[model samples]
Target: MSKIKTKFTERIGIDMPILGFSHSTDVTAALTKAGGMGVYGIAHDPPDKVQARIDAVRGQIGSRPFGIDIMMPKGMPESETLESVQAKLPQANLEFVEGIAKKYKVPEATTKTFYNTVLRSPSYFEGQLQVLLSSDVDLVAFGVGLTPDAVGRLKAVGKIVGALIGSPHHFDAYRDIGLDFIVAQGSEAGAHTGTIGTMVLVPEIVQMAGDLPVLAAGGIGHGSQIAAALAMGAQGVWLGTSWLATSEHAQGDHAIGDRLRGKLFAAGSGDTRITRGSSGKPQRQIRSAWTEEWASPDAPEPLKMPYQHALVGDLMTAIEEHEVDPLLHSPAGQGVTWSLELRSVAQVFQALSDQTIAGLDLVNSISKSP
Candidate 1:
């Protein structure tokens, strides 16, 4: 029997329907080389750093296809002058953040350093997009704060515009604005995700998306899950947490990687807490001192999207620079446990695709009926 082709497979110029997520340059290039799309998250990086990362991926992958993931939640767009954004931030919030910094034993200079740099801006997506376009990105996917104008501009360039949404209702919003595809990300997805789990989210989004392809995300790592998604009518799968453990994901420091791997094996289900500790929105992160303090009643209510993330920006930098585990924040979904043993992006993508085909075959055989 011939292999089934998915709309996503054709649209993104990949042989497999996997969308590997990692901030790691190596993993992004490896996934593209291995026949699946590699999506790099650029929302958190400064413009210069983001450009360098894109350049690194291009240098590695050459003409192979890849995409960029920019997070746009309900907050500031980076387009505004950094000074303007800094002015808008409440003084009280900064004071509170500093208090926590002091309590965490974070150096005053370190706390000040975050505020001085890593300014918040979703609007900078266009600037980042412009950079990616100059490179070799095949698709540019936007999540959270996607604007109509940005969607139009991306499509005008003949680029595939994928908006990741938590609900089917938002699909209409994007469709109305002309998105090429909608990534129906369930709550199970890692990094800033919504409440609805993938099982119910994918079909709902597919139905609402009209002719646009819907890629199922959140909690999908294995072939059976991909097969289930395809059976339910999704055109492809966007796998993030699955790639965290891949050899390509050198993004995580040694401590972060150890904690992540430890979570997988010790499994009473790794601890999860919905905290406004990172990026402000109530995102799920592995339980840690920062998140725990933020969740505590004494801590001020996490600021809304931009404010929340802005408040903690310095701390994240500190964590990275110091290589501190407690300060290391990871965005993850329920499916992260399936990720173990770092392999190349190609290996992970092939495993997902091959398994999906096998799972689909098994289902079809059963359905062929006696």
Candidate 2:
């Protein structure tokens, strides 16, 4: 891929003007190797494993620019254990979650849930932040909770800082926080997003951002979408959900990665639902029996932040652990419509680049014709 230079790609030093976000380290490294930026989602991992993952990515990419994303929801305890949080849960919430397990006949999990290890506590965020601050990673982005001191700390260590914002207000709050780049994630995005559409949000953010680089996120699947984003003044595209179905993501979980991969391949643009089921935030995920149950009139109002995650923690583990087909899901965007089949990350990356090149050529021809 020839360099598709943009403020983001040039400043961040990548070939393709696309940023890939995924929980899989392989996906992260694959994007970097394939001429794009990859940001490993590390909010779910324990503090100790954070450095190992960064080192692993560094090994694969060998000093290529890649990043890590942390999601820290506010108002969580300084530190709280899963056991302690579980004990304090309301009876109705517990029973509701229990009923879902029973309804689906989900098997008991043999291993501990990842969420069990991740508390939405301030201490937990601090631990992860400490890992990023001291590590050799090139970029740091906040997906949810934007810490006031985190940007300065990361910058101090000579790291580029970025954040995903969902609205104009969010941009207002973060504009002065010293972000090197901004991702205008519309509601069409997969998880933890607000109600704005990408078309409207991108231009607004771009104009408001002044000279700061803006990456248009959400609802971006095809090269035409990438071209459209550039035309809207976005310096680049920030993509996540599309990578969920990539061959790299299908690295096959020893537990149940295959089933999840199949589910993702089978899903479409219309198959997602915006619910508070994932983390008590309006996140778009593949529609499943679990979401349906939660959407029921009988279902209790979902709990907040860590509590909601805690309530579904084991159940989510068991679903993946047992291959609960109807209940399996991932946070994905409407762009998933384009990822109907599994393709290698490089293959997909090339296709997007080719299409973008063609799209830009078409635009150039049109402009010259008139």
Candidate 3:
């Protein structure tokens, strides 16, 4: 058995130092049953759908502790209706998407219902927060920073609030703002990451955070990396890309699971690039023709925030619906090269535990020999 233990596992009541982030209820339940915490990604779902997903995970986990991650940007603009945002998308970008669809032989399909779904907008932020407060979720994690008032409200309702940060400066800024824990996400991470690598970022944030527990995220797909993170003073590892190829991830005709699995299988460490074209935030994504098109010189600049996301909402829907393999892309870290095999969540957790123990043993042996 692995000897890894930290305040994070103790506080969260989990056996392992692995925290899996996924949008699938199956994956979350499997991770919980495997003795690690599973944080469901609900930032992309509306409030009503978010509650339903939470309930689904609860139905399977049965009293096990799990968390939910949401995006609550600090000092967000005033709430704007989804329609209003969609209407503001520039025609040039619209024409570009149309051109891509035509070039790819994408069928004509109305994505009106998809466009109307308001997942992560300023307008739905409060409603999403209320959903978490009223649910049985053991923890609530903010992908972006949250206001002190919002953090206090979550804590008042007996929820442990955590935040993900990319730099020590952001950590220093928000360290004393009532965050229960901080996830130091490095540049190699999937979505919305910073410029520092995990080796440098984790320890820096851990030092800056003082007693607050820091979870090392980004480029952590293997057990050796988990042991290394613990050695770097991280309480645990926050993993998302590693779970993307798991058996329990969304896999169907309409889902991007199969394509993502294929891409990870064929990808190398250098195959991903960080581009702001996806959501107007610099995020690491598997290189594909879709990303290539966005990076081309003739492509219009990606709009900011909700507008960029809104602009491509229907295009993404069409890609998913039509299974455009060339255009299919998902947020994946540099460690994606390690995720070549499709394993069950339980198997993945077991491998992490075994590898962590082996890695620690290797270090111990080397130290004794010296």
Candidate 4:
């Protein structure tokens, strides 16, 4: 066998240690074809859609290894069926949302779409996990917190279980559960993120996880950042914002990518806020009118998980669709500007490897000179 590259490359059966984060199968397939791991996000897509996406990636990459990321929080909506959960939703939940919507002045349309997603099972996490297991996925990464029991089940199947964690506490929990890996996400990341910034969180998790491979996440966009993550003891880097600007991203809007690429630093600073008003739980998204409203001193406190997401999920959709006022758009990390141009996923992967290798050499040269 050829010599293994990074610690992550050896473990994931890839030539490069980069893991592309995107919901697009095209991106996943391209990354895998380029000799890196592609982690497709199937959190919101329905099972059929997920299956098709998986099939597409499989066709493009053949048996090349890839992974899937699912959003399954421990103890979220316990009903066996999505219909059951939707029907059984407490009126108090709706009332609670109405109160918050009024308090935050959230547009009526945005509230509807946000609620629909949380209540309906577009892709029930458990059901989709079953589908993923049926396929030839190299690993499974949970996009949210999970219980020890869930981790045990995943491990029993001889699959890697990667938990997305934001703090040292989360790192400790995943480590205790013997998770295969942990994505150490800092606040500078897009979409869902924790209060801890990447610079601080990456090292903390590397130290806390001990031997478990830590995949530095969040604001990692360029080779320098990836090198920094490796120097800090991360085995690899998990990327999203960088992928969003790629030609394969399916975001279908050059302007959106342009806006993201242009405002990378401006968008990633302390200006980012943690709010459950978006998808429940504390996710670091761009500060928007919606987040500002909920955070205002006079505004009412947001409800708990699922409830808050249920209430506002629909509204978010409406905002995206232009039916309601734009509140906030999903984004993460300070490394977005590095993704200024729309390159192929394969090109991006190659760039990361080249840059990381160059960075490592620089580090070694400096050490020798001293």
Candidate 5:
């Protein structure tokens, strides 16, 4: 009955061409209940926590189809231990984090055990995948990269598998590898992304994918952008930053929620920067003292994947405990300029749908005028 239906939406049983990618189960459930699909990001959590989060979402949304996103590094070292990884971290990087703590006057962090178990071994990664396979989730999405064997395994279990790719080369490589869909993430997207902007990247990926449905991501925060993506041949839009300012975000601490909401509201289109300093990958996050300091000439070069993540794990916790605004940062896309208000998930879905319809109507009217 909706004009926005696409093969992707039909396959997933959602009414609209929107997918909310969030870390919060509440956000995921709310988006699904509102007619768009929600993709729970389970990359950071341990297996037990991941299962619990999935169970909670399943309980809330009933049988509505939902998906899970995970990080799958293409190239991991043959062997790595937490202690060995820590040993390799440069002293300058440690000094830099300490200097930031001292400058912010942040107190010592609470003795909380941070989980890096998944990064410690390949078996841990397999364990996380096993948890998803055993669950009732309708779809599984992988970022960074996924192996053909993994894709085959998920497909064999009747789980729809999708992957995020930035270039046509990557898409071509995986297109025949049994992917049900592809998310074309651009440079303007939050988290780990490549250097291509959406306008150029989407159409290219759509053409390259041929029959495989493509979802456009990056710089898409409003209905007009959705309309643009559809015109560019994207089956749907994959959104991240737009949901951070929504009411359903999992900011348990009221102070932290308020701080994040305020920063998102205050940020303009140009306030974000792409840097490998935070995650050891090119992630677009709101510019802050942490990002700026990392860019300084005296700063140490960031380590690779799991190592960089491990190095900052405890430090980020300490900063969060202290509520250091300058040091606090979240991956936010260039679309953040549109996130100037904290609205409910339902309101956001409605707004995007209405705007998309209006945009389509305008195009129809113009095409018929002369």
Candidate 6:
């Protein structure tokens, strides 16, 4: 198939207009091989291992222009230790976590779980940033906190930098920063997201972006959704949730157990809920006993960021370690409905590309009608 030419694709030098972001390097590499731009989300990696991880992913995607995604929030703790965050845990929170653990019989994690590996502090973020600045990454798209200084640093290193924005108000800052691109992620997106729907958010950001390229995200898992984004004036589409269902993800480094994957495979659009339970942020993820417990009246008021993650980190790690199917869940968008059943990266990419072309043809036919 011929390349899908868009302003963003042309500028970024990719054959496809789709930009795939995932926490798994396997999915990242596979997306690149499948023709889209793959952006590896390394927020979970230990700071010291960032470079090695980048190298591994680069090795797989050989010579392809891939990117990395990180959460760079402003005003985070400069140097907080895990013990310090643990010390702040209230007795009530501890008891609540214990109760859940007891109910599920989750065992103590034998090895270091990803929860303990994540240190939401400035030092960790900076460590990763420094490594990326000198790595082979082609683009940097950051979410969560707004960091203006990092933009200059990334550009200084000759890397294309972009930010994921949920609102139109965020456009000016990126435009002023001369960001290479902007991704307007809507509320329907999995994980941390804003309240605006993609339909409204994409056009607003596109209008604000003007000549700057815009990639529409959130609740976008199919070719028609990509087509819709293009129609909204976006130059391309940025996808995160779609990659979660790919076969590469299931077999990746941090892949979930068969039970959890089964849950995701069978999930419907209504199976997701937005809650601050997992990360102290409003994250839209698949509904599970964990999320349901948080929604219950017995649940305590969730803590803020960093603290919230610290509070539940152990239990989340335990749930995954034990394969507690009832409690296990992952961040996913409403678009998960369309991506039901695991497919290979190549197959998913081809389907989306074909659908996008067909959708464009349909739109063109309708426009020329009497």
Task: List per-prediction Cα lDDT, in the order shown.
Answer: 0.71, 0.85, 0.82, 0.69, 0.83, 0.85
lDDT of 3 by residue, 265-364 (tens): 8887899988777777787898988889999999999877766777777777677666687887888889888887888888888988999888878877
Candidate 5 weakest ten by summed lDDT: 111-120
Q: Report the candidate with higher lDDT, 3 versus 6.
A: 6
Clashing pairs in 5: none
Off by over 4 Å in 4: 1-4, 79-123, 251-271, 323-328, 367-370
lDDT of 2 by residue, 1-370 (tens): 4678986788889988999988888888989999999999887777887898888789899978999999877788865787788889999988988888888788888777575455578877888899999898999989997877888889989999999999999899988888999999998898777999999999999999999999999978899899989999999998988788777776632222777778777778898888897688888888888778889999999998888888888888788777887998878888888877878889889998998988888887884533
lDDT of 2: 0.85
Judge candidate 6 against the unseen true structure and give its global Cα lDDT, from 0 to 1: 0.85
**Candidate 3: misplaced stretches above 4 Å?**
1-3, 75-79, 110-116, 251-255, 368-370
- Model 1 residue 165 CA deviation (Å) reads 0.9
Per-model TM against the reference:
0.86, 0.96, 0.94, 0.81, 0.94, 0.96
Clashes of 2: 0
Q: Rank the candidates by TM-score, best first.
A: 6, 2, 5, 3, 1, 4
Q: Which scores greater on lDDT, model 1 or model 3? A: 3
CA lDDT of 35 in candidate 6? 85
For candidate 3, the lDDT comes to 0.82
Candidate 1 TM-score over all chains jointly: 0.86
List model 1 lDDT by residue over 165-242, tens digit each.
Answer: 887677656678877777888887777777888999988888877688888898787889999998988988888777
Each prediction's RMSD over C-alphas, in Å, is 3.5, 1.6, 2.1, 4.5, 2.1, 1.5
Candidate 2: worst-modelled 10 consecutive residues by lDDT: 249-258
